[model samples]
Target: MEIEIFTLCDHAQDFNGKLVIVGTFDSISSSVYPFTHAACSLAGRLRFSEKESGVHEFKIKLIDEEGIELYPAIEGNIDVSKSVANYSTINFAINLGNLEFKKPGKYAIELYIDNEWQKGLPINVIKQ
Candidate 1:
C-alpha cells in the first residue's frame, strides 16, 4: 500500500498560492482502514495547541473496518514547523510494503478539521 498525502491550501486565511503534502504507503495487505486529517495554521500556532510557533501537526489513525489498527508494518510523520514561511507547497510520503496490498477495493479515509469529520480519500488498489 503506497499512500500519498497531498494537502492544497484552498481557502486559508492569508495564504497566497497553496501548500501541498504528499505521503506514500507500501506493503499493505489490509482490506480496510481509517485516516485522519493534517491540521495546519498560518498564525504559527497549532490548532490543538496554544504555543506560538510556525508549526502544525499532521496525524492520522489507520484502522480497518472492524476497528482494528493496521499500521504496524509501516508508519511515518513529518513536521513543517520551522520551514512554514519558505515554501508554499509541501509533500509527504509513506510506504506500507510490510502489510502487502493484495486486492482492489474501497478504502475509507477520514479527514478532520479542528477535531471534526470533514471528508475522506477513497483509494482503489488494483493489481499491476
Candidate 2:
C-alpha cells in the first residue's frame, strides 16, 4: 500500500469518484498563544495492491516540536478491498475540528497505517 496524496486543506471530499481539495496549507500565523483553529481537513488517497484486502487501522496525530502529542490522537480504521478492478484507490476526508494550540512553533500532522508511521505534514505556527 502507498499514499498517493496527503495534504492539509480547508476542505476536501470524494465527490463522485473525484477528490476535491481546496485551500491547501502548511503554516498557520497567529498572534496569540492559545490559538484556535476552526477546522482543518486531511485529504488523501490510499492505493493498495489488488490482493490487499482487509481492515487496517489509520491514525492521525498532532504533535509539538518536542515530539509530544499536543492533543488526543485520532484513531480509526480503513477498510481496504477490491472495490474496482486494477487496484483500489481509497479517498479519505478527515476533519480536525476546533483544535487549539498553546504555543507557536513547529508542529505536524502525522499519519500512521497499521501503527506504522507513513507520512507527516509539517506545519509551523508563527506568532506575528
- Whole-model lDDT values for every prediction: 0.33, 0.89
Estimate, for each residue in 1-128, the C-alpha lDDT of model 1 and write its tens digit.
11223222212232342332333332223334332223321111122222323333344444444434445412233343433453323333232223333344444444443354444444444433
The digit string of per-residue lDDT tens for model 2 on 35-110 reads: 9999989999989887778888988898999999988898988788776686788898888788888989999989
Clashing pairs in model 2? none
Model 2 TM-score, all chains together = 0.93
Best by lDDT: 2
TM, every model: 0.35, 0.93
Error of 2 at 31 (Å): 1.3
Estimate the lDDT of model 2.
Answer: 0.89
Model 1 bad stretches (over 4 Å): 1-53, 72-87, 100-106, 109-119, 124-128
